[model samples]
Target: MNPIDTLNLDFRALSTFLAVLDEGSVSRAAVRLGVTQSAVSHTLERLRQALGDPLFVKSGRGIVPTRYALQAGPHVRQILDDLQSLSAGPPFSPATAEFTFTIAANDYQRDLLLPGLVKTLRREAPGISLQVIPSGIPSAEMLRKDACDLIVSPHAPEATDIMQRGLMADRNVVFYDPDYRKPPENLADFLKSDHISLVFGTGERPSFEISLNARGLTRRNVVTVSNFSGLPEFLRGTDMLATAPQLMSKHLLRDFAWVPLPFELKPFTLLMLWHRRNQNDPAHKWLRNQVNAVAAAMNKLNP
Candidate 1:
């Protein structure tokens, strides 16, 4: 029989095939899909018969996709994504909707936007809950893999399928405790003082740090925390300084004092990102509008 004529797979089989291809094991794919190993095996058998290829082959103790499966993966994924977009069928009413939206964001963006978002949801859509996850240098795959519905960050990963909008812009400022030390008045004073900085898990340096290093300006970094939330504890009682976005002073670092950086640095804009598939969905569009409104209000308040 012709392979095209034999193809009679349903959405479930296609989904299971992609799951196994991604997890590289029937057992692991079963766990991901919340099905038994035998069920996953049965689905794969159907997919193999339909496609006229053994999609996965045992490689050592694990499994790997064959060339045909590898070639078919993107097409299958696009098909599923298109089908998902179709599920957003009826006009969405926030007041009656009941679903959880998972968003990927770091502490800085989380503290800056989520609280306001929570309030808006409570007032407008009480049934819709939110799940916030850490966004480590936002990637398009996070959306494609269904890892998150949205991502808020300063960095937007380059991808044709990902869409982004600028939320707010803030200049870098020096954060310190007034009781512990006075603000540095000059570049020499700024560089001489010990510093506390954020170093993310990805080991990517912030733009200001990269620019500073390129200019041959180095501060004495006495402490490096993994996230912005960890900065205040290390800085509260010491003479150390941290360079962070000025907008943080209103929320996460509200108790602390912040001053203009001794040296000039360009402002960074926070961006909200989502997959293009979600761009036209009414519910997703509503959430994006709320985030945009919150960012606008924050900009007005700070300006």
Candidate 2:
């Protein structure tokens, strides 16, 4: 028989053949497959005609596989396994894949996460390029439209349909200049101090204010900045104290002094957010794992 002609056999027939072989009876195979016994027998007939072999035959009460059927079973099983892996998408190969990933993160994250991530990428996958953008309205929209690959943020917006994984936990710290004398003992004292608020964008301000209102204190914002990088600079000359993620403030505290926020607030969970479309993508999965690993390592070091 020509090889091309042999390739014309129906996959359904092969599946039915395997089912019958495994079940040891057509009736059992039909029940397993939710089909009539006659249909299973008919499928076996077609498979036998295509292969030019009596793939299985009656031997007493149970069906017996012929030599050809026994030989073909493992090969058929391997083929099906390979097809299933392909459907799920194969594992990522970082060395050969030339792909660009766009990530959204705030400036504080850019300071803490990107430095270590970049060093690892340079050593491992030099071809993969990364674009980091400010996390805000644009980032949320980009994620929804599948324009951005991932987002690293303290809190994910509820409006977007994105999957989030907690990367690291950090509390909000109140940062002040070293020479600033007033040390706050509680929420009332903290509220009395001038504050510099870090606003990602216009949308974040309302939610942030609402969260503060729930605590029975309204933030009397002396100044608002677009990025966290400016917070350190803004603190140098003014009495204004800044509230930011602990990890980011930890890096800044090398040159400045800070204290824990007096009011009881939830610890910030920095999360990685990605659209559902790329949830199972091999390359995307690899990147997500790398980020998770880095965050885990950093947490271990700090804790």
Best prediction by lDDT: 1
| TM-score: model 2 vs. ground truth | 0.65
lDDT of 2: 0.74
What lDDT does the true structure give each of the candidates? 0.88, 0.74
Measured by TM-score, how close is model 1 to the native structure?
Answer: 0.73
Which candidate achieves the best TM-score against the true structure?
Answer: 1
lDDT tens digits, residue span 1-303, model 1: 677676666678888888787767899778767789999998888778877799899889988899999899889878877777788788899999999999999999999999999999999999999999999988767887789999999899876457899999878899999998999989999999999987898897788899899999888998999989998899999999999888889888888998898877888889999986687788999999999999999889887
In model 2, the clashing pairs are none
TM-score of each: 0.73, 0.65
Instruction: Give per-model CA RMSD.
Output: 5.6, 13.8
Each model's number of backbone clashes? 0, 0
